[model samples]
Target chain A: MSSFEFTFWTIVGCGLVTWLSRIISFILLKKFRLPTSVIEFLSFVPIVIMSALWFESLFHQNLGHLPQVDVGNMLASLPAILTAILTKNLLWIVIIGILSLALIRLVI
Target chain B: MDDVLDARTGLKDTLPTVFGYIGIGLAFGIVGKASGLSPLLVALMSAITYGGSAQFVMVSMLVSHSTLLSIILAVFLVNARMILMSMTVAPYFRQERTWHVVLIGSLLTDETFALSMNKLNRTQNTLSFPWFNTANLTAYFTWIIASLIGALLGNFITDPKRFGLDFALVAMFIGLLYLQIIADQSMKKALQLTVVLVTCILMYIGLIFIPSNFLVLVVTLLSCGLGMVIKHVLF
Candidate 1:
């Protein structure tokens, strides 16, 4: 197959896989009853996933080496973290984070 | 008052995501162009896959000439979390039509899911297709447009970091995580703190041993499982 054929097919396959993973649970569970335990487990999904993603952002990892903090991101996070606690607004937090990081890059 | 899902409200609620997605999308497009993919293909990938990390990995794998099946499988693994996220939000759409449910699920992403969940908690409103579709498409178009621009600009955007645009999504994640914490009314404060703490600690250690991609799915599953067990045993 040509390179275009390969890339095109690959993209199509990926799109199918992604959409299926997303929609399968909804279709299946629509018929079957979700156990209470499953519901409880689902409740924890948002916070747990968010926490994991957020933490992942604060560190960098290399193959065969321990993870280390990205000091730049960590330092930039301070002001955004504070804004999150104080205002609890998503837009403000993002703006503050970008500006803070921009300022940090400018200074050091 | 009847529950309504106006596009305006949805667009307003999803505004924050626009900022995050544009920067990351630009980065993805730039990388795609550097990988020898055309600008049109890059935008198409963004539209079709609609996944941030998975698309990035797909681009890298394509550059390396990974098999089509392997790319599909890897995409599934990276996005397995979507199944869980879909299920989490499914309860809200139980009364909606099957087609609507499918539509919402197709539009699901980490950012959209978090934002919707937080909005639901804050407003205590029923989830409607109009509201969600509006929000989803806003972020969706932003991402695709940004990718196209990035591809077009290619070498011009050499370093996204110089402008701190690299930090946009991270900041968004931080904001969403904080929102989740505040919006969580399910578990007690102590348990919430424990789950988050355990998630970070376990993920930190897990990253050392496991590839970061696999670690996210495993860490999320383990942390949530442990949180449930703790809740049952203690609370």
Candidate 2:
């Protein structure tokens, strides 16, 4: 298939998968109750996923490669991490992160 | 009407989400456009997928010319947590019409789920549909608009990275993680952070063997399973 055709179908497929994953549980759980253990287990998913994402962003480069630290990204993340802990504001964290990265770039 | 008042309250409460969405959504659009997606296509993805991280993954995968199946699977895995999130919030809508419940289910996102669940837990009554609906809609539109504007400005402003917009997603995730940590405030807070850190380290090590796309799913299940086991043993 052509690239455009590929992109279109891929996006459509992704949209379908996303919607299905989200709605299916809502439909299923309406009738049945999950075990308390399972619910408690699931509560940890977000923190795990978010941490994985954060680490992947900071470290991973491409498929099947060892993690390589990008100094700029890592240095910039220090201030963002502090802002997140201190301010606990999403917008501020993003703003401070971007500003810190820009400043770091200017300096080094 | 009561519906209007509830919506107004919901919107007022969603101001922080609005700001967060605008920043990250604009970054998504800019990255999408920079990676050669058409402005309309970028906006369309935001509308249809309505997933922040998944859409980012989609753009990167597209740029790398990854297969359609891989792209679909990656996006699915990254967003699989939504199932857990949706199920968690589903009980609150037990009294609502099935159609309304389905509509609300479709609009579920990490941010909305977090906010709505917190509100539900604190409030005495069932969460009014309008209250939750209003907050979802505000974040939804804010994301769409921010993305469209970013895409439109993509041609004129060539380098988004110079402005450090590339870090937006990571920063947002960090902030969200912080909120999750603080909101729990359990005595196990340190243990929870340790689990997250250990899982990330393990996933990083797993990169040598595991495909990059599957790493998130594998690590999520592993870490969460480990956490449950530890919690079960301790408490």
Clash pairs for candidate 2: none
lDDT of 2 by residue, A1-108 (tens): 127667777778998988888788778777878898887877776677778777777775555667777777789888988997888666688788878877887888
TM-score of each: 0.96, 0.81
Assess candidate 2 and give its TM-score to the true structure.
Answer: 0.81
Which digits, one per residue and each the tens of the lDDT, describe model 2 over residues B52-87?
A: 879988999999988889889889988887776777
Model 1 CA lDDT for position A52: 87
Query: What lDDT does candidate 2 reach at residue A7?
Result: 75
lDDT of 1 at A83: 91
Model 1: colliding residue pairs: none
Q: Quality of candidate 2's docking, in CAPRI categories? A: medium
**Model 2: residues with Cα > 4 Å off, grouped in runs:** A1-9, A88-91, B1-20, B34-36, B56-71, B114-128, B185-187
lDDT of each candidate versus the true structure: 0.85, 0.76
